[model samples]
Target: MTTYLLKSGILLFIFYLIYRLWLENEKMFLFNRIYLLASLVFSLLIPLQLISFEPSATSKIISVQLDELAIQKNSQSFKSLAESLDLTNIILAIYVTVFLVLIIRFLLNLFSLYNKVLRSEVQFVKGEKIILINEPILPHSFWNAIFINKQEFKNDRIPSELIAHEKAHLDQKHTLDILFIEFLQIIFWFNPLVILYKRAIKLNHEFLADAVVNNQFREVTKYQSLLLEIASNKTNIILASNINYLITKKRFIMMTKKESPARIFLKVCSIGIITSLLLFVFSCKDNPEESNTKKQNKIEKSSVGIEEKSTLPDEDDTVRSLAGLEIKPEFPGGIEEFYKFVGKNYQAPEEEGLKGKVYITFIVEKDGSLSDFKVLRDIGYGTGEEAVRVLKLSPNWLPGTINNKPVRTLYSLPITIQSPD
Candidate 1:
């Protein structure tokens, strides 16, 4: 969720900066706005693909034990060692727990808010040739079908425009959007992307609602004046922005500033954004893959393996390679148990090697078999084969998969071989 939000935030920020520049009537710079849209779509619709782990809809308490870490066969052992080396994630874990609590609390708040809105009395009033809902705020009376403070309508300064505006909110199903955005924030609380999402949705709603009210009044001047007049007041139950907030000022200015917004600019932006979105959707995205050097070495080794396909490369017939069999782990313990499986069966190569390190890359197959092992960082012929030799005798490893279906994994083993004759 954190990573997704960050990705979304970066995209949104570009869009925002571009939009802001557009607002200022200046040159616009657009980056990959599609990333933001893709992120938004994925966050709301395809969260599973975007997220690293399945986020529990309901919160769960996490237990910590430095002594007993869960391990999966054939998984990397570095995680435990790294965590033990650094205590930062311990604090992050606590933060993550608190964040979950916040999500739960926010969800409950939404339910309460929804119920309150639903239960509010609805009444319509048509008097003095105007339409308004009398919401049961205080000093209530009839304006339209909704009841609100009668004195409010009676105020000599009361512009009928505000009523139409609020009514438009109810009529256009805007509250549902607010509810949706609130839920998103709850889920992606730590993500600054959520903040950007909130802002975007709010801005869109205001733009939409403003348009609705303007269409009804027909007198653009009166509506604009009304917004400016009320720009100093307090409004309760606002989703994010207060009625009299800074954004409100921009909104009011846009409402008043009669100008033909550059259709060309909006068009160009739309084109650029759509193009970027396409790239984001189809690109070979960064989920998890080997580093460039390792990938290159793996490719080279694969080519070598193809050429040497007929030979076993060593005389150790008693040590048959387990590299080609896929072994299922009893439990998926992530990465620690993976290395434990390696450690359990692998004999550390003799220290009296030629050079600094012998790095071999190998594939752990679906049947818990290891095969196609190749030297990535080679010390020499002896150490290179030694790396493969030790790996060949490795215990049947835990099979890995992408979506619960078994898949072959390429792993690199780097060993420091000391120089001694």
Candidate 2:
């Protein structure tokens, strides 16, 4: 478990670096405003690595032991380990699901891009004597003569000012930005932080474009009306662009924000600091602890004494000798005997996701016969039954003694079905 956490942390750092350099290309805000991006990145990466590792056989065994300790939960420390295992599994599932979704979305976007690039029917809006080259990208509105499918503009009259707004997407190359974010979305689909980043970049794209349009186009009120006019239509797809659409009211407010440039820069820096600290702390903490000494498992003593007794106990004599009364024998004399029986009798059943835990408990009669069994931890299907069959057939045990008398006892065994490490 400790090893897994450390590995996950390392993967996350690599992922972050990958994001900042290759993905962001210094154009995005991984370093700019850190709060959302940094935190989001953390959430995203942690889940992803947690899931991707997918608990090896040893890890699954460890998890089961932890879970048993949890079930029998007497120790707070052991219980915590068990809880952590559960948490890891949950995080793993979420990360995998998210990543899968992101991959699908990426493929969808890619297909869309490929389809568009290969498309025909170029329609350029003619301005009497001025001929224009219709860009397939931005300002994809009826006003700009760039409608993909034309149910969009039957009797609608569009204002010219809105055309400048979408043109900003083109002039500033926001389509590429959109594509970049779309690509990132596919890669880090499991990370909600990346999703947030996409949204932020997208919103920022609009804001930047809005600022450009407002700065360059001199017709503010007219453009606002144009925005309202074109706002009637929005693209059906999330990645698709509508000429006049607002993602959030906040984008509108940013357009009117009165904050000085200094304050904005300070805010960005503050966010950066917090995010850097979080990533650093998270990455650093996952490393193995420094210890002055290392510990190894103490020797595993066999259930049977080191020496073997060659003489077989006489059945009736054994019953009569101990406490003067007959008792059914319990578990095979020792752990070695128990497992040897299992090895000889064991059968692997066909079942997936059965590699967690298999706990069994049975009554050991004074004569060593196991009966009335139950699965303490059943892996699945025939696994628990297989485990039971092995235990039940293990001949006689040296019946447990109570005051020089033989007695039946309940013996509990929890066998974790871990893969060979």
Q: Which candidate ranks first by TM-score, i.e. highest?
A: 1
Residues 1-421 of candidate 2: C-alpha lDDT, one tens digit per residue: 3433443445445545544443332333324334334444464465333222221121100000112211111111233345666898998898778778877876786576445544634444443111122332224522123344322222233344445555655555656655655776665554454565566555555666666777777655565655655455554445544454454555555555554556556655654665565555433321111110010010011112322222122222221122122232333465434454565466655354345545565665656566767664464667679778877677776766533665555444554454322
| TM-score quality measure for candidate 1 | 0.60
Error of 1 at 132 (Å): 13
The segments of candidate 2 whose C-alpha lies over 4 angstroms from its true place after superposition are 1-119, 123-138, 141-160, 171-173, 180-196, 286-421
> How many residue pairs collide in each prediction?
36, 18
Q: lDDT value for candidate 2?
A: 0.46
What ranges in model 1 sit over 4 Å off? 1-39, 42-92, 104-108, 111-122, 126-158, 238-242, 245-249, 257-269, 280-282, 285-294, 297-334, 344-358, 378-390, 397-408, 415-421
Q: Please give, for residues 78-117, the per-residue lDDT of candidate 1 as tens digits.
A: 3444565477678678778977897777767556445544
> What's the CA RMSD for each of the models?
11.5, 18.3
Candidate 2 — number of clashing residue pairs? Answer: 18
